[model samples]
Target: MYSIDETYKNIEAEFKPRSKWDQGVKETALAVLDSLDMPETVLPDHFGSRRALLLNGADNWREYSYGGCALVYNVDIAARFFTPSEMRRYMADGHDASMAFRGEPLLDLQARALSQAERVISRYAREH
Candidate 1:
């Protein structure tokens, strides 16, 4: 299994940042990855699948969602604040929330993302 640092480096090399928000998210993602303790044990399946999704997006620039933002958010949050089981639960809940609105009201998605960001930021702050 690849270490989280190795996985993150691979991701950074593969996904070019296009905007300030994109660049911030990428940098934050790497910071979150670096903060992980048992990075080798976390998100084995999810990380691989998400990385593949990102690679696909990189190969086809027209595909928007696969570009790693949501994947980064999910993995970062899971690594920082959740157990494997809770990670699955919250991720499914977030997906369900998004689907219930037919992707409109994007507030649900934004809330989920913001919650993840807040948690990761707070944890990083407390640790450092």
Candidate 2:
């Protein structure tokens, strides 16, 4: 099982940005992730639990949000985990509710990411 800091560092080191703007975010996110202490668990296949896993042991707000987005996308990459219709509904409800707050776009994005986190949790609940 990977420690949070180790996983975070690994993830950061692995981040190959497509643009210069993302460099700062990637670096900052890695730093924040490094500072956290998270439980070792299977990565989520759904959105909700994925976000929760990302938020686990997060010390800073930005780290919490970034992790959520990263984890959600991780699930997204699986493709087979969620149907398009389910993903669409999940994203719509999640994004609107999450993005409603007044804050940086990152926070809004994090909120959107969290909206889908529920699916991950639901899947986990059934599996266990």
Candidate 3:
């Protein structure tokens, strides 16, 4: 039942680091969140209605994504989730497709993430 702000605070504290780079990145993320006009409460359906979560990335993104998914799952907000590169090849084809025609690595990653998010949302809508 934590508000999004409270959840973010908890995450910030959990990610507090001794390394300068990590600390800086965490601070930047929190600052961006703080500047946004967000809802005071976390919506019940914030993670989607059908309980499927798709998270992308390999390194830091994977860690943070898994952590958030675990937190939501702990609170009964997520029933199932998968980190990128964990599933079968067939299941990963869509993500691969997102990178097919992209030139830049960053743009390809962004497109892949967007594609995955849209897929998750659409699948959730259909299943629920």
Choose the strongest candidate by TM-score: 1
lDDT of 3 by residue, 36-91 (tens): 34637442344542122223222333343344422222112111222223224314
Segments of candidate 2 deviating more than 4 angstroms: 1-6, 39-42, 56-128
The C-alpha stretches of model 3 lying farther than 4 A from their native spots are 43-128
What value does the lDDT take at residue 67 in candidate 3? Answer: 44
Model 1 residue pairs with clashes: none
Worst 10 residues of 1 by lDDT: 119-128
TM-scores, all models, native as reference: 0.34, 0.34, 0.31
Query: Pairing residues by index, what is the TM-score of model 3?
Result: 0.31
> Where does candidate 3 have its weakest 10-residue lDDT segment?
72-81
lDDT of 3 at 103: 47
Q: lDDT by residue for model 2 over 1-128, one digit each (tens)?
A: 34444455455555565643344345445543443344354445554544455566554445655655343342332232334564465466445533322343434444433333322223322322
Local error of candidate 1 at residue 112 (angstroms): 6.5
Q: What is the C-alpha local distance difference test score of candidate 3?
A: 0.36
